[model samples]
Target: MRHITSALLLSGSLLSGSALAECQNTGNFQQWLNSFKHQATASGIPANLVNNALHNIQYDPSVIELDRSQNTVSQTFLQYAANKANSYRLTNGQRKMREDRPLFQRIERQFGVPAPVLTAYWALESDFGNVTGNVQTLRALATLAYDCRRGSFFHNELMHALRLIQRGDIKVPEMMGAWAGELGQLQFIPSSYNKHAVDYDGDGRRDLIHSRADALASAASLLRQYGWQSRQPWLVEVKVPVQMNWALARLGKKLPVAQWAKQGVTDVSGRPLRTSGNAALLLPMGRNGPAFLAYPNFDVMLRWNKSTVYSTSAAYLASRYAGAGQVRYGNAPIQVLSVAQVKQLQSKLRARGLRVTKIDGIIGEETRRAVRLVQQQMRLPADGYPDLTFFQKL
Candidate 1:
């Protein structure tokens, strides 16, 4: 499986010679960029390709800013799904599916991945190829690699990008994409593109940038590689019995659909839901909010994006492509916490003797479980979701 990371570039405040010297006791970003040349050459990447891509590349301070601020965008599952799968996106996705019916069908037949799933990813990654980022891929990688926050990760990606250039998979000028060096219509990072991209059109090149067939096929290929089952539902919203085990609300704990149905779980309409495959109960908001039974394809989507919000959005969007309606967020109103506010909550949890070690402003499972503990102590719902009320008490 391929990995992804992000980075940044030069700043006026960081340009002071002494400050540059103090960064890892090596040198400034420019000096590090220059030094990377030798490493690239030694790694067997052609010196000419390296020079063409990195010779005059500048540090992008904006990349770092975007990377840090990305996590601050927190929203409830309903809100995120609504924004991602709006009527505009759904309409455009359906039109694209009709326009490219033959290609989508071919991809599905070959890869055993549904067309809607791939279409959802295509829409989400680059707005159906209408809004790819303008950052120079090499420079963004170099800036992030030099930043040292997640240096080794981005450094590896940067090297793979250079290899892609040397191998002539993509041209130097065409390597412009997201700030994190993601390329093409589906925005696969350099490493993921290298591993999963395919020449589906038989044009002798796996051109994810300009070739719709290649991009769509490549995305389907990725899901297939991750063990996607054909035509299986990724998720289905259900009405869960109030007296069921609350701990099963955590995502990814697989249980049979019949087993959950035995416990009074039913489809959105409260009718008995029958499914042959095992699924996981997922309560993104809380037990009091909407509930879903996520299948293996949902996990495959998670392999594409670690965020549950993103995976759920993709799943929901794909369902919409199948003519499914909007999600019903019954019960209490959804409340979300900003990354800064999450950090504050994490700090409070840390003080209360919870293992909240990296306060990276992301409310991951650890933070969520910690919230559950705090809620239990305070005699609250203990649903494991944070809100203004919970944070206010802290």
Candidate 2:
């Protein structure tokens, strides 16, 4: 996670909307901290534990700044995939899988999640625990909980962070992680840690920060809880026909493998697509970029990280580790829209009675859906992706 900024707070841009009305801290930090201490103690957290963990925890403005500065609007799916699922990660992930073959086998047999998928998450989340983070988890959670924006959400996370300590899952000093208070190699939030962390090493403590076995097993456990299907395909690169109705190429529109094969979709080798069950045509960078058939397991991946780009990258990385070849970037350099351009397009889309929740310069799911609606109305390829041409037409 990135550091937070204080300038954005001065403009009130960081603390707007209903978040301001719900759990917004209007008083001093000390007062808020004291009140939170009482609440924590009341919630069954030991008074000493609460005090020790929260003592001298000044509000971290940088945490809030980093939270507000997060922007994935400028990154295309290919660029993100290239950065995240690069050669280095692939090599290291393969090596890790080979090194820990026995552990992985055990985890897969018990959790029903493949080793490659867990390795991909391990590689992507913290580079296999090389760089978990350095932020003081409690302080960051306290800061975010005190802030007006997302205060209530972080407040609950703070409670869970304290709960982790109370349960002896981790020591207060060891509670260091991302700015969002996500702990461990998997970068699980405190709530997730409480819910899914396991003591795979059988050392009596669920130590995710230093225990690879625990972290990997915990990751698999989390995926299983999110409805991962055993021995099912998560993602498969495919060649989509150029002449088909592009509207069908959407993440929400799932069709059976045989149905997609009938519609002219094939594996990357140009062979007919053959797989059990249904899959969605995932054109993350639009029709002019790489394509994949996302299965139900892919949806389970989304439950881990909602970003389509990140989920797709993780799934593709897993496939690569499992012996799939490089993704084929479609012919032509796909045009991308700038953040400002995306905001303008969202404004135009919202004006036309489309359901765009916010024009915050992010090409999120709603924005993509709105763009697809416009493209369909204009008789263009409705791939649910925004490009310069689509923006110009709008």
Candidate 3:
């Protein structure tokens, strides 16, 4: 939550023999188990698995704090990358790239998920092995499973954690991670590990904590499983022509790359559009700010987390490692406006009876087209640029 993608949230202290003994008091744990057994078993999670997990689980407060705190702290994409690209992160990324070249190469060879991308995750998620926290896995899962906001997801994942413990893959103490119940390096969720973790190190245990091979492989495997197209660019900064079509340059609606090219959109340097895949356009800061052309891989990252900022940040971070310079957008047709002005413009259109969705500050494609229609109706230029005058009319 602290700009960290995965949060492991195992107990800070490894359970001592005494604490283990306390939790293993069969009756107390059974009471906790009963609350979930009925629902989990009815959902087709085997009863044995449910008991196997619940019998060992406990509550972790750190995870709850992390979940709650995450919403309060938001960092812009540049700031996130810059903060993570500190000397520590870069040094670790470099060390991992060299020390684990074979492992990184394997991830690339197997999944076409490049090494830098995996390494970026390595540095970002866990500081390349320097700081995998010591949270108790079962405890973290149990806490999240009990939390109402994400009980169903955590409950299902908790069953998998129990399955791992029951199978003797990872014990309670070593199952450490960030604050959010993500496990090991490359910060996998329990279900993510259960499905794709590999014994790349072949050290008898697929230990994501210590093994670079296992972590990178698991990370790539997760991406591939989520439909990452091999060798496709995930994101590209583009130049919007002076009279860019406000409606088409929107993420809310699908537009063929060719159609966007037809509308005079080009790569940041004004090169002809080279991509063939269907893509969507997004302006997180409205029309006056940076614009992006997001491809299939962008959607794949969205599967990890849906916020436009997060996905774009990942794409940009990975691009930095890939030797691309920080992208600069063409001069914006309209000056950047604040959320208030943007919303006011939208409200005006709605007042004029446009089928606008809401007074949400974000002017998505529908809102853009709707604004353009209103502009044309007023005999204005109809370019769809938001300004104080646009709001004054309504």
- What is the Å distance of residue 241 in model 2 from its true position? 0.9
21 Cα displacement, candidate 1 (Å): 19
TM-score per candidate: 0.87, 0.92, 0.72
What are the Cα lDDT values of the candidates?
Answer: 0.78, 0.83, 0.66
Give candidate 2's whole-model lDDT: 0.83
Model 3 lDDT tens row, 71-123: 31134344454565565655666666777777677778888898767877776
lDDT of 2 by residue, 323-351 (tens): 99988997467898877888899889989
Give the top-scoring candidate (TM-score).
2
Model 2: colliding residue pairs: 3-66, 4-62, 4-65, 4-66, 5-65
Question: Model 3 reaches what TM-score against the true structure?
Answer: 0.72
Off by over 4 Å in 2: 1-25, 331-333
Residue runs of model 1 more than 4 Å from their true location after superposition: 1-26, 332-344, 358-362, 373-382, 386-394
Report per-prediction Cα RMSD to one decimal: 5.6, 4.3, 8.3
lDDT of 1 at 290: 79
